[model samples]
Target: MDTAEPTTVGIINRENWIGALPAPVREAIEARMTRFTVAPGMPVKRAGEAATRIFQVETGFLSLIGLHVDGRQALITIYAAGNCFSETAMIVRREHNHTTIALTPAVVRQLERDDFWELYHRHPEIPEALCRKFAEAISRQMASREQRATQRLGQRIATMFANLAEHAGESVVGGETRILLPITQSNIADIFDVTRQSVHREVSHLKQLGIVDKRHGDWVVIDSERLRQICSY
Candidate 1:
């Protein structure tokens, strides 16, 4: 599937540093920001790269990935439009631990580390906004870790689908919720830390139970509430 360019798209959720800033500050920052347009499947940043800049999603989605010594790749997380990345890395002056890529064609806004800090110190509200954003990120990370540790494979898949629906779902003709993200079976296996066969079984079970359908290269949740219930809501 092709992703629209950032210039052709608009922000959806307002969850990033850009949106968090007070209006005047946001405008000033935006004036100095540099925009990058990434094509679908493009590599935005790689592991062990210097953290020279902080990034905010202006349009489209990105995936965070980790590589193991055994040559295995893991999917750490997905970031949608209105999300921020690399702030912690920039602050700590460390290389990035994960590789980030465009999950679809994307437009991202970048600020030099020095520029970001200048704003951070100049505006009192900057730290407050960043604190809230980071706090929420940490909370979600902890919750996701806990859930993955305790939940069964099926339940975990359900939870993942439910979360995706909440973040990126769209209404369909028959009251179903559709997610346009391209999630392959291999990706699911990586996320669940399971085998491809296991993913196939669980996905097939979901399809058999009338919970989800694959149509037009995307996933449609036919009964989102039921899926949420399976995830323990």
Candidate 2:
């Protein structure tokens, strides 16, 4: 997709790196930052590229894709609005480890490495806040790993759904939680290390249990309580 000027979605989350900055500091940093828009399926950063900037999603979603040894793609992670990514690579001055792509039309703000460090030096709290954030991320990763190793297939699928619903789902008129992101059987297969057919069967089971439903080419949580109880991992 092509880039365009930033759209107006005022900052909502105060915990992010940019949001944490004091008003004047934020203004100074915003003066140097570049805000742009991208269309769905557009490439953000390719794997092995020098990580010169970290991206914050003002709106829309980006999926991180990792290349498997067998020439396959794996969904490494998902970043939606209010999320900051590629900071680790920027910190270490290393290449991007995974390719990042827009999952929907996106408004993104990018901060260059030098600018990021400059902000850090300007505010001593920045590094501590960032460290806490990364620590939380690491904790989530550890929990996810544990769940993947021990959970049943159906439970794993349910957990994935629950996570998406919490992190990216939208509320509809009928009170159902709708996940607008593009998720396919192939994506699930790659994420859970299962076959496509297995994902299909598990999805069907979820439908049968009334835990989830398909709507408008996306998935919806029909009974979040049941889903949470069954897949509390």
Candidate 3:
């Protein structure tokens, strides 16, 4: 078991780290972690701000973003639960690498790089936790990345919906599969390396084709099997 020390009363949830690591390593990290939460649209890191901590999302989503000279920001990554981030700032403060924004009400556990390294050295498994989680759903992420890279906007959207059904989709009342797309259009653009207007038009096209539906800020896939056959994810 990790033998560092007792955890702080209200820092990171000890359970999460313990769950991610072997017993001993978990104990090591539990001694030096802290936790915090953020609301939707809040900045996790500001432009030109220093990077100081790394975070793992426990719930909801975070957007890694870069700003253009004109003060407009483009999404870079939409990080979901179990993803680690802010490594650049955690070890040494540098100019803000990217602006991180909360895409929804979110809970996160964080540690300064120094503390993180201390724990990481003791627990080799911590670094792999994100990969482990992603691996659990590898087929889906692979198909998604493939679509993002090789497919046109329409095909990307279609394959995404299809993959969701097999990966995270749930059956609805009419025996149709629904997958939640909690990400923003800007972030979708980032995934496909396309313009936001392009994504907007493609999404509109998908809607018209009855491939999916949006509800309460989430995209629910409607005809995933058909979508897969046609889109070829």
Candidate 4:
């Protein structure tokens, strides 16, 4: 658990789900949210814990990790700044299905389940908006699964980098896109259920082609158009 101090202001971001709400509703929700900071590698929520709050990332990256009965763990997904998650569990009144850990120093805002319901009751648009968000999320997950199932290893790796660049990349000098998050070959291997060496091979090939490179420990998409062409199926 994080013991960081919590604040009540500056919680709304137009990019996040909460910002889609009506102005009055956004203010109400913000009033109920508590923003706090989390250190890298710290657990935000763990499996089997009651889903008492819904979280929105303000900054940094968080990885959702799922565990298998045989003691194996898999990376479900990574959430970046301006993303909201864990609503499904809270809505269903069930325990969290996965563990969320900070991949970098993060700032997050959480709204308690009871407060969420209060707002839900008052605002009719809330559920409809959430339904649309859930649908989009499911569509992305299905596409990712399909890619993993049918795409060649190199294509899969390329596609992964392209998607990550969209989600976490920032434009830099020379038109390159730098993925701000710390992603490793091992993390890619976990996502595709492949060995780290295999992921390294694909990454090295991309590096050799000058489609991607690393700068200051972050992955940089040197040639975004070329990467897209490679990932196109």
Clash totals in order = 0, 0, 3, 0
Using TM-score, give the best candidate's number.
Answer: 1
- Which lDDT value does model 2 have at 186? 87
What is candidate 4's lDDT per residue for 13-101, written digit by digit as tens?
Answer: 12356766677877787889999999988999999999999998877888888875787777767876767888999898999989999
Off by over 4 Å in 3: 1-20, 91-93, 123-149, 162-172, 176-187, 215-217, 231-233
Give TM-scores for every candidate, taking all chains together and pairing residue i with residue i: 0.86, 0.84, 0.68, 0.84
| Candidate 1: stretches off by over 4 Å | 1-14
Tens digits of per-residue lDDT, candidate 3, 96-136, equal 77778887688877777678777757666876763444354
- lDDT (C-alpha, whole model) for all candidates: 0.79, 0.78, 0.63, 0.79
RMSD of 4: 6.7
The TM-score of candidate 1 is: 0.86
TM value for model 4: 0.84
lDDT of 2 at 137: 65
- The window of 10 residues in a row where model 2 has the poorest summed lDDT is 5-14
